[model samples]
Target: MSFLPPWVGLLLALLLFGALAAWVLRRGLARQAANLAQVVTGEDVQAQAHRRIQQQHLADLDRALTEGRLNANQHAAARDELMRQVLLDQAQAGTALQRGGDGVTGPVRWGWIVLLLGALSGLSYLQLGAQQTWWPVPLSQRVQISATSPEQLAEQTRVWQQATQNRPDDAEAWLTLARLQAAQNAHAQAEQALARVLALSPEPDLWIERAQMKALSAGGVYTGEPWQWIENVLREQPRHLNALVLAGSAAWSEKRHAAAQSYWQRALGLVPADSEAAQGLQQALAQAQAASPAAELAQGVAAPPSAAAPGTALAGDARPVIQGEVRLSPELQKHIVTGATLFVYALAEEGSRRPVAIWRSTPTSWPVRFALSDSMGMGAPPVLSSLAQVRLVARISQTGSAQKQAGDLQVELPGVKTGVQGVVLDITGR
Candidate 1:
């Protein structure tokens, strides 16, 4: 069975109503034509002819009485009868003229009826239908998973689970449901779903998804079993981007910076330079290099005497840095108007409101990157390096002030250590 386009259905409905209107109009016009023809060529003409005949008959009767061929009483009775017939014919003629005038005016009445039908139909559609929301849903876009709230995602997961249960051998269905479950943070259930897919068909993609779900279920710590699954995938398809990124994230979290660098670099080479994936991979590579043991050793080897000396500026220093991209949520962009400013800042986890460092930039199309280093400090002294843990904030200020207030859109990453990267903060709520 072939499905028609949505616009085709709407067009058909409009045509159907238009055809009905035309049929009604055609019926009304035909009825009026019949009435007009009846008045002109029917009873009215017949009645007028009858009246003339009656007058002639009376004249004949009078002549009969003049010529003495008929008696006076007979002529009188015949003239009286003829006069009554003439009066009746005149009444009928008047009625036919009145009916013909009504038929001539029928178009106005039918016109009102047609106009009323159209007006009512339009008003009903406006009130009850999504007249403003008509758009095409391409098959690709329909299949793509969207970011959803927890409640909505939970409902979707349930629906997908039911589908899989009904079709146990459906590998694609199981995989898709696993992806959805993972998106909703149901990591354990997602892992189980992926297991089912592997049981039915052990595909490389399913292996990669299994590794991802394991990593997520363990709070993004891609070590032990999760790392093994990722390594297994990489061995088969060395340049698989998903497996590489997952492996890189795991290695970076465990301080295995060299391995993280190698994996992310491979993944980076696979994407367009200006793509979002490339940007994310670059951030990860930068973080890995910053924390790499070889890089640190090289820095120590290149240090000057003052840099290594005790009681020097570098003696007690740990140059902690926090870097990330921030974006406004797609759903929350409508609240923003002109004069809005984005303030990305860091504050000590348990300390005062004074920021360790802050960066100010005007709002742009989002996923904008910002790096808050010790150099961005306000008034110097107790800088970002001094705070072991801090919270990073991305705020859209209505009044362009550091002070938070009602109606401001903001998001926070709490207890974030320095040297963190790829910390995407979505400013979704006040």
Candidate 2:
């Protein structure tokens, strides 16, 4: 059973329940059949006895009149009276036998049993099962609202809002409505729905969710009143993943790189290394590190000798792979602004100045390690994999331009062949 798919388990459970219900119905029907048999048997015996007694009474009346014990008028009157009495006695006996047969009780008892069974089944299912959700919705109508397009979600939000209005006390329904509203960027309305949920059942996750809604309403800002709610949840459950992610994003947006790093690093530890969430966090961490101030050790270091082996595969690429560290000179760092964009890339050793692979960073720290491989390759043709040799370049482009400009500080490592190691490019004040 544990190995079976969830839907299969559900199907088997439904079949079992149906069989039980059928057995119960069959048993009730059999009891009714037994009651019918009792009624038939008793009625048959009573009718036979009544018929025999009636015949005997007629005979006795005929014998008396024949023996000449009375005149015609008296005999006729007595015979009429005897016949009337006999018929009265038979009707009284039949009424008694019918009552004694317990015929009415059968249907009445069955009716009560049926009602009880129905009520019990309904109540049990409502209490223990998924309630309305327990029943399978038709496949065509069961589109998950979360996965729907923005337009579809907008329509769904209206429908869900109307439903929640009709069922004001339904906490789960309100929560669902809140999510749909938020998805459609109706943050204010979503917050109101979340308030209703909290009123019904105050939960930590709800608080965090409401805070997130508030943040979205403020155009991705995570500070002010909303942060209070988020902070409260974090205080209670420090390892809460959603709260951590929200906090990190908010900090990053605010340029509070250190705080963002703390929150995101914690979250990174909570997820699997290969998961998408982990990958996203890794990217975030890399950005955070780049935004940090360059370390002293990376200042003014000479480039490592080119270690490109003649037949060696690019760092790890089947073709050319260029791996190195890019750093701004300490003297240059004094002139550059904290958040200036840095572009580090590799180009063909000869030909047009188009890049094979590129990475952009805003460095707060120096000597940021970089790897250029096929995965990071851009544009059509002359890919990193096709290059036998390449030139690596790093540019601190205050204007965020790829082409060289007057104010840009640039450095290049030329004639570096594929599969090089310990290659370093340093930007200088020269």
Candidate 3:
């Protein structure tokens, strides 16, 4: 059953239901027909028996009169009595036949039976069947309402607003209303609904979401109350990924490149290396570094005391030696094209777009071992050995292009010290 597709299973179930219903209906109709036949046959049999008995009594009375055993008056009285009894019996049999005819012994109405069975089957299916299984569009995907008319959207918004009002304590209702309002760009109303949701739920993620709504309402500026909410969340859960990302964006908006880098770096370490969120954060970090290289270098030189953490870069002499093993996820193994280019590189900083040392090759097997040193530097001065720490990246490019493209598998290992060994970079995502 699990191997069958949803539609196939649904179809099989419907067919089986139809067959069973037909069988029951046919059997019932046949039984009713047989009962009707039996009622008619019984009436005929009773009439024949009454006729035979009356005929025998009349014949006996005539013979007795002829032989002088009974007189005419006596014979006439006896005949009348027998006839009266016959009429009573006939009357009782007629009543019984009438009752049978009025009940199940009557004619079977094919139209009514078909209609009843069909209706019952349909109702049962509606109650028991998986309704979405046969739908043309899958329900798993989010329904896109962007193409809806303005009037329709307004009607939907009104409905959701009424729902929230009716169920004031329902956090889900409030959250739904907030999302609807946000979709309509009604940021102010969305924020209000979100506030109600936060009051009811009070989860950290909800707080971050409300903070985002506030930022959107404030023209994409996370100042005032939005920034305060983010700060509060960070203070409580310093490693909260969403709060860190939001804080980084806020700092970037304020032209605080170093702070943004720090926040994003911490957030980056929390997510899978090949995830879209990590990629976006890495891109943002690169832009921040490019915008203020001097700040990045200064921050690198005088590292904060907190930078000594496991994921953070440690202050040490630059040693240009990084060795790592790159592997593809089992599911992605079949996607590896023949003669594909494999790029193993090291970034001078955690978020630098340009690679300081790069080693490119065509790999033919799994778990490719790689080593990067100062000699493989793309340029002098800012080589791998000149940096205290570097971020390692391994990519399998189908098109053999140096730039990342669609369908390219890649992975990253950030905050790797210069003399790192046995680093594993798994190309698990595209």
Which is superior by lDDT, 1 or 3? Answer: 3
Rank ordering of all candidates by lDDT, starting from the highest = 3, 1, 2
- Per-model C-alpha RMSD: 18.9, 16.1, 19.9
lDDT of 1 by residue, 1-430 (tens): 2246556656667677677777777877777777878777787568667867876887889899999988988888887887787778778778777778586447675776778578757755753476544444322123445535547766877887899999999876787787777664456677898899889877666787787667655544565888788888889899887778777766655656688789889888998999967876776676567657767776774321321221112211224277678877778877777767787778776533345566666665677777776534332224575567788888887876544556878787888888777788877787
Query: Could you tell me which 10 consecutive residues in candidate 2 have the lowest summed lDDT?
Result: 303-312
Q: What's the lDDT of the predicted structure labeled candidate 3? A: 0.69
Itemize residue pairs with steric clashes in candidate 2. Answer: 290-363, 290-364, 291-364, 292-364, 292-365, 293-364, 293-365, 294-365, 294-366, 314-321
**Candidate 3: misplaced stretches above 4 Å?**
1-152, 293-430
Distance from true position, residue 134, model 2, in Å?
A: 16
| Residue 90 C-alpha lDDT in model 2 | 70
Listed in order, each prediction's TM-score against the native is: 0.39, 0.37, 0.36
Which of 1 and 3 is ahead in TM-score?
Answer: 1
Across 1-430, the per-residue lDDT of candidate 2 in tens digits comes to 1334345545556576666666666876676677667766877787788778778877777787789877788878977887787778778766766565555655765676676567657655654575454454322133234535547776777787788889988777787787776554456677888889889877777787788667655544567877888788789899988778777766655656577778889988999999977876776666545443342125433322223322123332223366677777777888887677776677776543435566666677787776665434322235565567887878787765443456888887778877786688888843
Number of the top candidate by TM-score?
1
**Which segments of candidate 1 are over 4 A away from where they belong?**
1-143, 300-430
Q: What's the lDDT for candidate 1?
A: 0.68
